[model samples]
Target chain A: MRSMYKSSLIACIVLISVLASYSFAMAAKKVELVVWDLQGYSDQQWYKNANKAFMEKHPNIKLEFEPHEGVPARPKFISAVRTGNAPDVGILNLYWVKDFAMNGWIQPLDPLIEPETRADFFDGFLDYASYDGKLYGLFTETGVATVLYRKDLFAEAGINPPKLLEAWDFEEFAEAAKKLTKDVDGDGKIDIWGIGISGSRTGGGGPTTFTQFPFFWALGGELIDEDGWPAFNSEAGLASLQLYHDLVYKHGVSPRESYSYTWDDIARGFSAGQYAMALLHNTHAPNMDKQFPGQVGAMLYPVPEHGITSATTAGGWIYSILTDDPAKQQAAWEYVSWMLSPEVMKSMCADIGGLPTRRSVFDDTMFASDWNQVFGRQLEGAHMKPGDPIFPLIQDEFAVAIQEVMMNQKDPATALDDAERNVVQRAKATDILK
Target chain B: MERKSGSLKQGWPYILMILPTFLLLGLVTFYPALYNIWLSFRNESLRTTVSSFVGLANYRRVLSDPFFWGALGRTVIYMIASLVLRVVLGLALALVLNIPQRGRSVARTAILLPWVLSEIIVTAMWLWILDHRTGLLNGLLATVKLGPYGWLVYPGMAMGTIVMVSLWKNLAFSFLLLFAALQQIPLDLYDSGKIDGCSSGGLIRYITLPLIRPTVTIVTIMVSISAFGQFSLVYSLTGGGPLRSTELVGLYMYQQAFNFLDIGYGAAIAMVIFLINIALSLVYYYALRSESLY
Candidate 1:
């Protein structure tokens, strides 16, 4: 009996030792987290430093970074998710959050993130990254549309540019544009245009919508109504379209070639002194300033007469996790948290000349500049693109309407009507609207 | 049955030798084609989780859409215009290059530069050259006191400008094929024509034209097929924009498939494009078929 009891005790000890060793080995095992980032991240110093620090902090988690260009990355990411070959994490345009979440291509980060961490993000950004009350991702940086104008041209024209937080009414803005347009050479040709707008259909008319939606919204235009139907063909919508048309044809202040301009074209043209003013994203403010010191200024978009309020569109990239494995999910969450932390966010935004999504990052000195403050104030009233999966189709139609009206192919009312009809048809067909 | 079995047994080695290629083609080419056709019959979209069989719905949608028809019309116009310019200019340049002259080799290489360039690079270069406000062409025109024109911005000019650029890029392709055919023509025939007091034009009309007729037909079919399916150039340059003035069928199909995530409808459009391509090839083959030379 004594020998048998001794044997049982030894056996129990052996089993416990075996289980503890197994658990330790599993805990120490390296988990490789694959991350797909927009192309050029590999070359950015901030990105490299963040990766180095992340790996140093989490020695057991290995990160595999794959760089892909934005244009081709969308379809490639979708294809990867469908084929079960998706990376552990991916950085996507904030507009894709709803679509991706709805399709179950990305997992919600709410479970992985703490409430305090979630609350640190700006309300607009959190809303942009959420769908159906679940937080799907966190924004990396933020962009808001503002009027980037030439300060020198404004001074030369004897027109005072609007203050940082101030805005111009439609009439004042149009008058200033007209005054700034000049034929300096006196060759019977206007050498410098007053303003430039992007009406290109690229990105499903993303540039047009991004820069022009503010005007529409300033007049109380709602892109998607309470009933989840497109309502951009209302009175406010017509007025906004007319404003764009008049700027080009009636006022003759904007270039007719605005119909083909992309966002980059507007930025480059503004830097080259082709236009006195340009309605562009504030992200271009830093680069423009760097190229031409103290020559560029930014302000809130102009409002129409009796306009409800001034508004601008906000957009940015969001980091999302696509993995189903718990270990990989945890690692991805750690990476996202580290990236979104105030220290990292501030450094990255400063390096890239972008606005940080976290509210705490605004406390930094870099964002206290007058130009940055202009964008920072605009963020207060900025609108995000609707999160509906069918919004892309609606945006495309809106692009067509903008082009048609600006090019004089159709009147404002008719253009809006046509676009509304198309959006409705597409929405109903997709079952997004009944 | 025994005789067939015997033949199969005799042919087994050849079949074994070609089996890998057949398998690869079946996997890569035939499978995707069949799957795309299958996808056309269903209501498949990236946005939706459930894919149900909705036979003929996608096809009906594509067929009834006015935009599809408009894009088709534009594509046809683009194809015809580019094809004509490519053929006429290709023949002219090939003739010029065929003449033995100083730096003829250098000239041929320089002419082939555009053809060898990637479509995206070519589009980017032309976009810079044709930009309305900051284009090299407009800048040059300004120096001469000429007016700056909206080469790519105007709806009326966008399609024509794209065609012109397309011609510049692809002229070398047709030129090379015709030039190769010119090289193969018998020198004796041309010499005889010359001895018979034939002018240069007469010699080319009789000997060169007839001898290169077959190659021209092949080049036409090839260029037509390429022009019909053009996507990267137009998509990158104009994005079928300026009020859909340059929206070709391929770009429309791409927008529906990738942009809108309506894969089923895009597949239907793709199938239609494939059928059109096959029909075009057949028409060109039969209409331009050459008789055998003795």
Candidate 2:
């Protein structure tokens, strides 16, 4: 009996030792997580540092980054997702969240995000990242449309730049633009234009939409009705369209060439001293100041006389996990959460000249500077683009309408009507209206 | 019957040797073409999860759309204009280089430079040179007190500017083909023409032109097809705008497929374009055949 008892004890000890070794080997195995980021974003010191720190903390996970640049990345990502070769995580524009979510290309973050962490983000940012009551991603940075003007030009024209958060009415803004337009060399040509607005259809109408939506929003224009039908052809829409038309044609403050300007053109023209004012994102505030110190100023967009309130369009990039593997999803969430932590968010926003999406990051001292304060305050009234799959089509039609009105191909109301009809047709064709 | 059986046995290895290549061609080329045709008859969109057959719907919609017609018209204009310029300019350059001259080899290499450059690089370089505000061309014009012109901003000028830039990029290709054809023409034929007291223009009109007819036909067809499907340069330059002024059918198809996610509609447009291409090729071949008879 004693010999049999000793044999059982030995068997149990060997089994426990084998299981412990197996667990250790499994824990030591490294997982590779593929990450896709915008080309420039990955090069930032803050991004690099955060990545290094995350890898250091999570020794069992390895990060492999593939950086994509410019407009082609969108189609490339779509193709990758369809082909089942997408990275574990990807950064997408906020407006793409809904489309991606609806197509089931990205997994929801609800299971991964804690309630406290979700509450940390600014109020509307999470809404921008959500579709059909589930958060699909996390917005890391935000930007609002602001009037970036040349302070020296305004001073020379004997015009006081609008104070921070103080917006001018449409008439006052038009007069200021007219005053700023001048032929500096007196060569019987206007060397300097008043304002520059992007009218190009690049980015699938994103640049034009981002820069011009403020006018429509300030006039209480709704892009679509509750049923996701075209609704921007109303009086507010016509008024906004007329405002842009008059700026270029009637007031002669903006140039006819404004019809071809992209966001790049607007920025380059403003920097080259060709335009006294430009409708640019607030992210340009830092660069403008650094390039022409004390010569630049920022203000909220102008509103119509009967405008509801001064409003601007807010847009940004969001990070979402695209992998269906539970292990990789957890790893991706860890990286995303680490990137959005207060310390990393503050550093990234400060370095990249973008507004942080987190409310806590706004309390940082770096965001308390004069220009940051201006943009930060602007964020308070900013409205995100609608999280609808059909929004891109709407933006495209709106851009066409703007171009038509500016080019005198059609009157404001007529152009809006055409655009509305086109959008409705597209919505129906895509079965989004049904 | 025994001899025929022996011949078949002898040919079996050769057929086996070429089978893999035929299989690869079918996989890469024919398969996609057939799939695209099938897709054109369906309602497949990236926006929706479900795909279903919608026979003639996509085609009918494309036929009714004014934008499609406008794009097709622009494409024909672009193709014809670019083809004529490339052929005429290419022939002129090829003739000039055919002469025995100093640094002829250097000139040949220099002429080929634009053709060798990547399309994206060429587009970027031209974009900077033609920029309205800060382009090299405008800056040069500024130095002479010439007024700044909106080369790309004005819808009236954008198409013309794109054509000029396209010519610059592709002129080398036509030049290379024509030059090679000129080389293949027997020198004795030219010498005989010279001995017959033919002038320089007469020699080219008779001997040079007749001998290079086949090459010219091939070059014309190739250039037409490429010009018809031109997308990258114009897309990068103007994106079919200042107001759809440069919206060629190819760009319109791309916008429909990728930008708007209307895959079925884009495929239908592709089929239409394919039919147009076939018609154009047949017309070119028959016209050149009649000329050859003369």
Chain A TM-score values, per prediction: 0.96, 0.95
Q: Residue by residue across A1-434, what tens digits does model 1's lDDT show?
A: 99999999999999999999999999899999999998856788998899899999999999998988875467778878888899999999877778888888899888899988888888878877788899899989988898988888888889998766788899999999999999999988888899988889887898889999998888888888777778888988899889999999999998887888899899989888888989998878888888779888887788876333568998888899999999899999999899888989888888888899887888688889888888888888788888787688789999999999888889999998999999888877756677
Residue-wise lDDT of candidate 2 within A1-434, one digit each (tens)? 99999999999999999999998998998889988898888889999999999999999999999998745577678878887899999988776788889888999999999999988898788877888898999988888888988989998999997766677899999999999999999877888899998889876788898888888888888998987787898988999889989999999988887878899998988888889999998878777788789888887778786334678899888999999999889989999999889999888887888898887788878788767777877777788888686787898889988998888889998998888888888778767678
Candidate 1 positional error at A340, Å: 0.7
Model 1 chain B worst lDDT run, 10 consecutive residues: B285-294
Candidate DockQ values, in order, are: 0.68, 0.61
Recovered fraction of real interface contacts per model: 0.68, 0.60
TM-score of the A chain in model 2: 0.95
The residue ranges of model 1 lying beyond 4 angstroms of the native Cα positions read: A305-308, B1-19, B194-202, B292-294
TM-scores across all candidates? 0.95, 0.95
Candidate 1 lDDT, tens digit per residue, B134-229?
899999998998858888888888899999999988888999999999889878998899899999999888788878888888888989888888
TM-score of 1: 0.95
lDDT of 2 by residue, B1-294 (tens): 999999989999998999999999999999999999999999988766578999999999889888899999999999989999999999999999999899999999988899899999999999999998889999999899895888988999999999999998889999999999999988998899899999999999999988888888888999999998999988999999987899999999998898878888899999999988889888888877634424
